[model samples]
Target: MQQFYDFKINKIKNLSSEEKILRKKNLELFYLNGFPSKKDEDWKFTDLNFILGQNFTNIVNTELIPDEKPFNPINEFEHNFIYLVNGKLISKNFDHEEKDKILISNFDYKNEIILYRENTLNFLNNALAKDGFSLEISKNYKFKKPLVIYNYFSNSLKETIVNNKNLIILNENSELTLINFVDNNSKENFIINTIDDIKLKKNSSLKSIFINNSKNNAYFYKYLKNDLEKNSNLENYILSSGLKLNKFDIEVNHNAEYSSSNIFSALNLSNYEHQEIKTLINHNTPNCQSYQKIKNVLNNESKGVFQGKIFVKNIAQKTDAYQLSRALILDDKAEFNAKPELEIYADDVKCSHGSTSGSIDLESIHYLKSRGIPEKEAYQMLINGFLCEVLEKLNENNLKKFLLKKLESQIHGY
Candidate 1:
């Protein structure tokens, strides 16, 4: 650990003066406040002992180019694209007709990002983020297509840990759709940590979708933080699968008036795969609105978790917020855990939270069996019907069909 830390400090010496100072400050904070442990309430349910047990001090190899480049999975995708191989940007100029409407640059390092939480994984990621990127959509530029960013991971020569930072800044009245897809190679086990910091200027809107179809026995942790200004709106969707262990941290802070958000997540799991999603929606200004709905389908011995909280400040009046988490357990050994919380300091706020989880009703299954359907097909039909309620909310027909196809494929493969 000492050798790796010393090597990173020396590596930053060649950067520009402004960046060097920022990197040094972050390093200092990393040393002062180290990793977090289970004693912290936020991390009590999730285990990190396996990660802490490994040796990530040595970075033996650098992959400048991917073994093979990934093309658009769907030919109908007409949007801009960016690919990250092992968390490093593929340095290439993409020639497009609307190139002048976009700005993409290398992200500047920041020490304060590490202080957002006391989690050790966040600390390690910020301390070792070698390369990342910044993106901005010009004002009033609404594209006909969404921008898709693929973060791909390749096997490392040694045990590898890659951290990538993304800073997305939206100017006033600008709107953009983003698909953050995390893909991987099947060679070895690695740790991939990504942090996204977003700033939505006044009246700017952002819609984001997170898709993680990880392969191999790697750990995927994503920390997402965003700030919304007055009249700004954010809609976020998450689709995750295929990892030994997966976790997500979504924190959105609303300090401006009349901004709103809708956060929805749908996870499909089978086998012993365990996944969790934790989110915090903070309302500090008046006349704001926010809502969250998280649903999951667990099969075999798979496990899932959803912890969501809504916080309204004293000054926040007429804040409308709600959270609901539901799960469908398909097997006797399958398990689901949910914790929904709400904290409000104002009297005029409207807020509510609830959690519900259960398996397929035997009466429903029996009725299907009596209708001449086999038991296995009956179960599949009922499970598919249960998840379709959540999928129906997607407004984009193309995206809805793409995700529904993926959902059907996974169910059939199982």
Candidate 2:
């Protein structure tokens, strides 16, 4: 492990001048923070011992490519595909104009903002990533076709650090739908760190879908921060399927009045898989609304966590905030931890939070059996109904249908 660390340091020392500065800044931040420990309230439930203990030495170069296709099951889905193998963009599939909108080749960030990003996990991607695609949608330009960003990893001992600084500027009265899939097809241990930054102008609408299907041996760390302007609406769905260790951080800031934010997440855990989703919503202006709902299904000895909080400032009167979390435990060994919180200084605001952890209803199952339905099929139907709420919000019929099929395949195994 020490040798691997030494090798990584030596390799990074050979990077270009710009990359060197980023790397130096990141290393300093990492040394100070040291991968949010269990002592940190937000990280108390997810364990990182396995990832920290591994001998990860490689820095996946752009020259290295994946010989195998990561996604064969859902090849029929129509999408504007931006494929990444081992953190590097294949370039052939990328459109220059579209790419520029999503990625910023040069950025001049303020000192405080830079420091915040550098100390965050996103910085790991900025420092170590070989390459990744960027997508920018024009202001108020609606996308008729679904935009799909696929992150693929296919090598053992390889770390794919994808630092994506996405600037989604939506002008007034425009709308779009996006499907993002973070997938790992390799049996090898890979690490992924991703960042998605979005800013919505007045009256723009966005529907986003996130799917994480990394391999059971992989570790994924993802962050999404959004800035909502007045009268803009954003609906988000986060799906966690495969991976040994999965950690996610999401923050939504209501910068203008009359904006709305809805966050929905579903996690399915099997084997020894571990998952965590931590989120925050801040109401900085008056009359903004935010809703959060998350669900988890744990089987075998898998573990899961959901931590969510909403803060309504004193000046943010007429704010409405709600949060809910539910977990289904299939076995005695399976475990779940939930922390849903609300902090409101505005006396006139409406805010509430709730959480539940339990197993499938036996009575519901008995009723299905009494109707002569087969046990396995009946059980699957009940499970589908439980998770359908999140999928139903996709709005796009084709995308919803596709996700339902994927959910079916996933639920049957759970």
Candidate 3:
């Protein structure tokens, strides 16, 4: 590990044009702020050993493009499909008529970028990104089709780098659904860094689902920055099933009054795997509401981590905030960690945070066994019931059903 760190330090001087510039910036920021360690209050639960011990080789392999279309599985997508192989979008699927709401360009790498200034992970993405999709939704434009983007990693020989950029602008009183799918069928090791910038206009509603079903050896680094305008609504969900290492960073800025935000996540971890999710909600205006619920099921020595924070500024009075993290350990060796926090500067507000971790319900399992059901089957039923509480809140019925099916597959595989 010591030698690997030294090698990374020495190789900094030999990077290519784009990589050298990014490396210099990343090294400076990483040195000044340092990696978010377990000792750090915000990262106390997530394990960083796997990421810190190895120095990944950054590859600029343009030949790593995926020829297969990402939307081939969906025959009737009601929305548009913007496909990305590695990081670049497929040129054949580009549409010019949607320019107002969707734009594809090399994201400007300016130092004055608002979202990446103080964020360590965001800094890494900006400095080391290869290519990405740029999506913008128009104000007051209603679309019938959903916007789906498949991020495919298909290289085996070298460790690839993918940095995706998404810009979503929702005009006042508009609505849309977005699906961000990360699918990897490769047998190689790689890294993915993506940034989503969302700006919600007044009275707009946006629903998004993030699917991580890589089913391969990969690392995921994702960050989301959302700014809510007055009287807008934003709903977001995350589903995790694969990958060896995954890290998610979310920042929601309530800039206007009467805006509401909801964040929901479901994770299933098995074998020797690790997953971490970190969220931050900042209330800069008055009368905004935020709700966050994260649920996990861990077995076979896998680990799950959840760290969330809600911040209420001095001017943000009458803010409503709620956060909950719950985990069910199927085995004695399985692990789960939760850190729920709240910072209130306002005089009048309602805020609550709760966390619970335990095994299957013994009483329920006993009752089921008494009814002629096997012990294992009874326990699986109990586990499914406990997880459904969060899934019920999902607004999309199809998505909810999809989540349940995945959950079943994960538990049965264990």
Candidate 4:
């Protein structure tokens, strides 16, 4: 860990005087705190021992850079593309004619927005990040094609720990869709941490989709802190199918009136893969709303976890919040854990939360089978219906189709 401090000091040796001072401050704060453990309330269920125990003496040195690499874009979409390979920005593509309509920045650290202060993971990202990116959508601007970011982890990574920071901003009345696609092909054990700071100005809206199809040897964790101003809205969708252990901790704040946020997560894990989705929704102002729904299908000895909390302050009257978690345990060895909480201080609020877990209903299966349907087909139909509740919320057909394809590949034989 001491070596990591030296690496940061050396990495920014060429930077401006101000950058050097700020980077060192962040690194020092992290070095003293270390990583989180089971004692931490939020990280109680998830353990970082396996990855942290490695005691990576030094950060991995990689030749891969995001601003120079060439990669193929998704064929069905006509959107801008950002490519990140091995924790570094490799390429960003915005149609030449529309380049001015968007703003893209990298490795240019900003001191104003320090996210998740005192949190070990957030500090670690800033202290050891290879590079970072910031994306902003201009005011009153709207684009049909979504912006897609592909994060690739190659199999060559050995005895390495990667960290990345991503920031996104939307001006007033601007609307856009952002997709983060993680493709991990690494065969050896690897650890990567991502920290994202997102702010939505008044009346702006953002639709975020995260698709993870990592390999079994990778350990991936992400922390996202989002702020929503007045009349702004945000929709978050997460689809996870890989990684030896993966977790996404997202905290959303309704900073002003009339803002709304909704989160939909679908996780499918087989073999020994494990994933956890933790969300914190804060209603700080009046007349705001939030909702969360999570669905998990665990196979073999796989494990899934969902922990969500909704906090309503006194001034946040008339807040409407809802949460639910449902799990389908395919094999007797599979596991699912859920903790949903609501803390309300206002008298005028509608908040509810519940979790349910069970195997395929034999009565429903028998009913379908009695109508000449095969047992396997009936089971597939049931699973599809259960998972579609979340996928159907997607507004874009292209994204919906892509997600459906991934879901089909995982749910077919279960």
Candidate 5:
């Protein structure tokens, strides 16, 4: 395993002596465990070590200086954007909103303290991460348009690994809508490890969306940790597709009364691709609500996984939680795995979980074809309606239309 990875802390620039020592210690810790395998309970369904070993021969951490490239803004809707090349912040524009209400800058690695040590990937990120962004929204301010983070990878990243960390904070009574858009077109094989910390203060609300622009050969992993305060609301919608391998580990903590959180995902996997979404929602306070709905469509030896857990503390009376996962298998070789769990110490909590997986209904396809629809079009129409239900709650018309088009492309294997 050591032969497959080459990491050097000195390769990163502008680090103090103490920072260097801390990074070295973290790198050593990551080397001790290497990449996670099926032995780890959280990663039992996706064997990351085995998968990476099969795809990459040598992965190194190197300094990146991206060449000058033109920035392409999304035309479907009006929005602000931040352009990042190879995880480095290149430019940002916030013309749609009040400039004084937003603050953006590079991640402050010098003053930030490490929060989690149990995950080896966190250790790797702490050691090798060099570039990322930190954003904060002022209190009582709301964005007039969504902000998009355009994540781009350079063509020179073949056989290389990139690690970065991001921080987002919304103060009291603030609101925001964020989009994490991946715009990679490079066919070169690479790896991306990312960690995001989100803090929502009292009375704040946030909506986050993730999606991809095109197909690529990138293996990606992201750990998102969110903290919610009193009367706060958080919602996440993931439509990421067209990657070779991807996994999202999300954790939400309801720290105060009347806070709510929701997780929704719809994925279409084709060919040999694999994708997973794992979530842990903790109801530590009374009168909190959490919901999760995951849907997947698999085709031609593709695989999908969903692991969801709800935890209610003893003091968390009147907690409400629900979880459901559904999968549609388009081929005999396709596979789907689901694991749902509940741990409640409160007697007054209302919690439930369910999972279902099956092949698409042949009767529905036949009925559509009988109405003069072509066989191919009938299958596509059925598939489109099955997966688009996840976005019914989204109120943004133009953005929703754009996402619907992307979802259709994924279903058609374009």
Candidate 6:
């Protein structure tokens, strides 16, 4: 393990003595476990240690100095934008929003606290993370347009690991729509470990969308922790399809009554690509609801996995939770795994989970072909319809159209 990776706390700039000590301690702890493998229950389906060892012979952490690059804004719809180069905030524009209603700055590394001791990735992030952003929306304010975070990586990043942590807070009665757009075109094989902490205050609402612009050779892992207060609502839409390797570990805690959350994901894995989405939703209060729907289309020996669990507390009466995973395996070598669980202590709660995976329906494809559609076009149409169902509940028209276009491109493997 020591021969494959090299990490030093001095690489991070501007740290106090105590902070450096804490970071070194975390690094030692991470070295004890290295990368997670099948032995870990949370990572049993995906052996990250073996995967990284196969791809990278040597990995190191380095400081990234932002180089000037042409910034392209998404013209599909009106939006505020923030540009990030290798996880470092570079520039931002909020012309469509009131300046006083939004707050944006660098991540607070000084006040960091250790939250997750069980996850080795979290420990690695705490030790090596150097760049990230903190964003907050003022109380009672709603953005006039969605905010697009452009995540761009430099072309020179090869065999380097980038770790970062982010924080987002939505005050009471505030609402915001955020889009995390990955715009990396680097052909280099690198690793990215990120942790995001999000808090939604009373009556606040947040809609988050994740998408990739093109295919790349990056390995990505993100752990997101969400806290929901009374009457708050959170909706997550994930359409990440172009990465070589990826995993998303999401944890949502319904801290107060009447809170609700929805997780919808649509993934198209081609060739040897692998992706997984793991979620744990905790209903700590009464009358909280959660819904999750995961859809995957695998082709040419690709792999996909979904592990979702819902927990209800003893006092969480009337908790309603539902989760379903469906996969369309287009090739004999393709694979899909699903593990759905429910741990309920409240007798008055309602929860159900199900998973289904199978090959594409030949009868439907033939029917489309007979209706004058070309065979290739028939297959594409069926796939588009199969994965687009997850986006049906999105009310934004232009955003939905943009996402649909991206999803189509990924399905065609362009």
Query: Ten-residue segment with the worst summed lDDT in candidate 6?
Result: 109-118
Evaluate model 3: give its lDDT. Answer: 0.72
Greater lDDT among 1 and 5 belongs to 5
Among these predicted structures, which one has the highest lDDT?
6
Model 4, position 68: C-alpha lDDT score = 44
CA shift of 228, model 5, Å: 0.5
Per-prediction TM-score to the true structure, in the order listed: 0.87, 0.86, 0.86, 0.90, 0.98, 0.98
Per-residue lDDT of 63-90 in model 6, one digit per residue for the tens?
A: 7676769877899999999888888898
Instruction: Kindly list the per-residue Cα lDDT of model 3 for residues 49-96, writing each as its tens digit.
Output: 336446354433233445655345444334466777776666534242
lDDT per residue (tens digit) for residues 1-414 in model 5: 545778899989999999999899999999998888899998999999888899988889858776657767789999999888877888999999999999999888898755467589889988998788899999999989999999999999999889888899999999999999998889999999888999999999999999987899999999999999999999999999899999999999999999999898989999889999999999999999999999999999989999898999999999999999999998999999999989999999899999999988999999998999999999889889988999998999999999899889888876
Task: Give candidate 1 regions above 4 Å deviation.
Answer: 1-35, 50-72, 91-97, 110-118
Per residue, candidate 1 scores C-alpha lDDT tens digits across 1-414 of 233323254443346565566555666675564444356667666655433344355442233344446544545545567777776677433344377878887666543343344365665565566667888888887756777777766655245556668889898899888887766656565666778888998899898987765444666788889899999999888777677667888888887999998888777788777788989999989999998988888999888988888999999999999898989887899888887888889999999988889878899989999999999899878777766666676788887777676556556552
Model 4 alpha-carbon drift over 4 Å, by segment: 1-25, 31-33, 50-72, 110-115, 371-373
TM-score-best of 2 and 4: 4
Flag clash pairs in model 2.
101-136, 102-135, 102-136, 140-171
Preferred candidate (TM-score higher): 3 or 4: 4
Candidate 2: where are CA atoms >4 Å away?
Answer: 1-19, 49-51, 54-77, 92-120, 157-167, 213-215
TM-score of 6: 0.98
Provide the lowest-lDDT 10-residue window in model 4: 1-10
Error of 4 at 296 (Å): 0.9
